[model samples]
Target: MSETSDAPEAPGAAGPPAPPAHPGVGRTVGRMVLALALGVALGALGTATHRTLWHGLPVGLLVALALTASTALLCRAWAGLGTLAAAAVGWLVAVQVLSMQGPGGDVLVTHPAESIPSAWAGIAWTYGGVLLFGVVAFLPGRWFARR
Candidate 1:
């Protein structure tokens, strides 16, 4: 009588391990949401504490720009710089529009030309601060991801 083994055969050869899950989508979305939420919350708090913090300093605008820039950077896509530039331009345009909506739309419209320099200055400051924030956030983000 031949003795036949009843043992099951193992995998022919352990197939290449499955690729690691792409955490990019979840990480990017989570970071974007958290950044926006934080920005809004901080803007509200700053506004409450001192309206000037939000109005005169353009903190909200800067925060929005920085968040936009960082989100694009984190995506590791080709559109990062373009997105940042576009956001800056959009913010500048929005500022112009808001300033034009002055009290009864009278003050600004009456002196639109005069307000251009100041409006541009404010936008410059906002974009500068946002760019700085993006640079600061990028390194730390990479470092954190490495660990």
Candidate 2:
């Protein structure tokens, strides 16, 4: 004997829900903008903290680079290539602007060879962040798949 239910089955009751559609243009743009803002904020934070030392170790520089790497990876994992590019550009721009000598002759990022030991912190912060961004951006896309 066979039995049949009187109620109709719901359209999607037999399978997993559909994957979400890709983001709209406005949302994508907004995400990229937020990414850029985050990058700028990170640059400022790194610049301010890249000169600290503890027991003759450049702990501040290490922290700055770690932040840079984390930010880049976050961007990539969040929205793919566009956000990553925006973040990298924003970070580089902020770092360069901060590195310039102010009217008072103060510099956020000094030449590595100019100071005995701490000066290298600035150089590392500036260039190492760029390198980190580049490396994260170029990583295999499969690694960042949204599955």
Candidate 3:
């Protein structure tokens, strides 16, 4: 006579296998902070990638695209959005108030208080990166919503 072997199974087994345990709070926070830093760093570096009059527009747009796509791929939705937001705010503060300069040694942007009409005439270029970032931030959300 031969003996038969048996295996254990869940009752009903109606659901898919469970996912891995969630990350800890500290780890999540750290990742979020890192994401924010990555976006900001991209902006700063991209800004200096080229130096010319109103160079911020093109460079900034490139930065926005790179930062958004990279961060969204590396980070979760909330963290990625937070990173983009921080990048935009940081860029604004840096160029507008801190008077940060581009590679060519000209200030990238100015404080709006200087005179919106005049200061904004050619100053919009500095915001291209942040604006693009904002626009890209929605893409991930939409894609995730489908799943």
Clashes of 3: 1
Which candidate do you rate higher for lDDT, 2 or 3? 2
Order by lDDT, highest first: 2, 3, 1
Higher-ranked by TM-score: 1 or 2? 2
Q: lDDT of all the models against the reference?
A: 0.43, 0.89, 0.53
Task: Using lDDT, give the best candidate's number.
Answer: 2
Candidate 3, after superposition: displacement of residue 41 in Å? 1.0
Q: C-alpha displacement of 25 in model 3, angstroms?
A: 1.6
Output the worst ten-in-a-row residue range by lDDT, candidate 3. 47-56
Runs in model 1 lying further than 4 Å from the true structure:
1-6, 9-16, 20-55, 77-118, 121-147
Global lDDT for candidate 2?
Answer: 0.89
RMSD (Cα, Å) for all candidates, in order, is 8.9, 1.9, 6.9
**What digit string (tens of lDDT, one per residue) describes model 2 on residues 6-98?**
998887787787789988999999999999999999988898889988898888888889989999999999999899999998898888898
- Quote model 1's TM-score: 0.31
**After TM-score superposition, what is the CA distance of residue 44 in candidate 1 from its true location, in Å?**
18
